[model samples]
Target: MTSPDEPHDVSSGVSSGAPATGAHGLGPHVVGTRVVVRRLVPGETGPTGGPAFTDVLGVAETWWPDLVVRREDGTAVTVPHALIVSGKPVPPRASRLQHVPGGEVQRRVRGLWPGETAALGDWLLQVSPPHEGRVRRRASSVLAYGSPDRPLGEALAAIQDWYAARDRRPELCVAVGSAEETALRAEGWTEPADFAGHAVAVQVGSVARLRRALGASPHTAATGTVATEHGPVAGAAPDVERVRVSVTASGDRIATGLADLRGDWACVHDVRTDAAYRRTGLARRIVAGLLDEVAERGVTTVVLHVLTTNDPALALYAGLGFEEHHTATYLGPPR
Candidate 1:
């Protein structure tokens, strides 16, 4: 049975170009995700005079003998699995925080790295000591966000000139799939082959959730010690609170991480687990310790960055309830 609340004719429903099953197919995997399902409506006729089919759009609540969906309006729709002819999981709706200005996010994340920064209107250029004859993207890329208060060509030229004068290859870091990245591409900027798989995923979540994942109450008292430091951006005003956490066993450091608090926001970075201790839960301890320290300081939100290709790190953060807020990739000079 299709929910009468949101049923449309099959003629305008299923896409003719694609298979009845969605790109990822329809099955148990789609439960708990927003999905659209098309099912036949007996005794009703569609616009084409054929048997009527109705489409249900909502979060898939259950997928077994029947598919249950909860619509945005708080209504639940149950459709028998035998009647579903087409369905697919769709991307989730944007969270309220997703609408925050990209530039602000760039500042919050990239600002955690040590660097000398120069501003170009709304854009920020940062430079740090070179490593292995190359600069880490976060340490030396132009953070391409809002308008540069100049023509696109002029901004590009300035970025090039600035880096060239510094004897460094120019790079522009932009939110992947953003208009800014697309615009730069049209101007010939390309992702360097060497950086092919280096896209970074910026993730955010609640501190309480991470604490829960640590097998403790969300409001557990802070434990361990945290050392405070100043903001990494040279000449910038110090952040409200910056702290580092380390996990040691037998007087040897096995893992460490840092968090910087800006008002109510905190960003976690520089997390590392000794290669020998990988998968030992030390990383989670480091994060949990950091969360404990920051939570006492009134920080409720936490953010972190993970390499898209690092399956372990991705899984670690996801398991702690972090969701990808955006992805960033560096664009190199025109080919």
Candidate 2:
């Protein structure tokens, strides 16, 4: 992943005889393994651009004339040789920064959708009557349950008893990878009849980095950014269509966005652009707009749920530095 410099040559590139000064000094360790590189700023770091040395994580793919690398989320960035400051090899994507399904991540995610929540041992139960056709909220929810260590049978029984009290059927948002398949099957917790074959992947990213990345995309910057939510993200699901566009100077609705803040963590939802305006980087602008809006309120982390089968959505989110948190599958509790 790295070659030597200083006392020795780290030349993964051909010998130019010189160290490639001015606009060509990217040594040679620019390709192969993952590396974090810092770029130099001319005058002041903040005002000129960002920092004196901005560190980016990605696998190096080119060297010399321009340094190119691919980010973990499938986005590629090229650094002009003039901006090269220093770089080093980093380990591959082994441990993920996104929290796992059964732990703190699950708890925080459940807290977002308020329903009466309870615990069957370590498992979480959410009971809320389906309202205004928000079926996800209405159905009884059992989360982080069905693991081997936890009592799957006890959880199933508890789910049945709890939902029965309210005359509702118990449904589950399961991270199957974390649970025992045998136990789930033995308990008869079958996948929902209307299962959409596809699943949703939770993604997270730093507010600041994403904001900068969004700024870097020329297409995204072509459109103006608008932020339309301030309080509790408009009560779960607000009238996204009715929300006024504050940033669009153009008469046409090029893009729209809204965000909800819960303490330091926030989720950006209902970001959309007119179908006619799809490929114009409107999606990036909307997301950046939401993140930029929330960053003003001291929000640090951003999250979203995208369908696993939606390749375009996955690529879009990943390119902005969002890492997958987990994928969830739904099931009907023991029938």
Candidate 2, 1-335: lDDT as tens digits: 11010011011322344364454335553354567878765565675566666677886655556777767554667887777777777664643454343456656555565457777666677765443344552124677544423466766777788888877677766665754444576677776655546566767777876676555433224655453634442234331111222335365555666565656676555566666656565665566667766777787877676666655555556555577777766667654
In model 1, the runs with Cα more than 4 Å from the true position are: 1-95, 130-134, 212-236
Evaluate residue 155 in candidate 2 and report its C-alpha lDDT on the 0 to 100 scale: 60
Model 1 Cα displacement at 120 (Å)? Answer: 2.5
Error of 1 at 233 (Å): 7.9
- Model 1 / residue 107 / CA error / Å: 1.7
State residue 142's C-alpha deviation in candidate 2, in Å.
1.7
Q: How far off is residue 283 in model 2, in Å?
A: 1.0
lDDT of 1 by residue, 142-232 (tens): 8988778789999889988888887777788888888889999999898887776578887787676556545442322233233333334
Per-prediction TM-score to the true structure, in the order listed: 0.64, 0.62
Error of 2 at 104 (Å): 1.1
> Residue 36 in candidate 2 has what lDDT?
81
lDDT of each: 0.67, 0.58
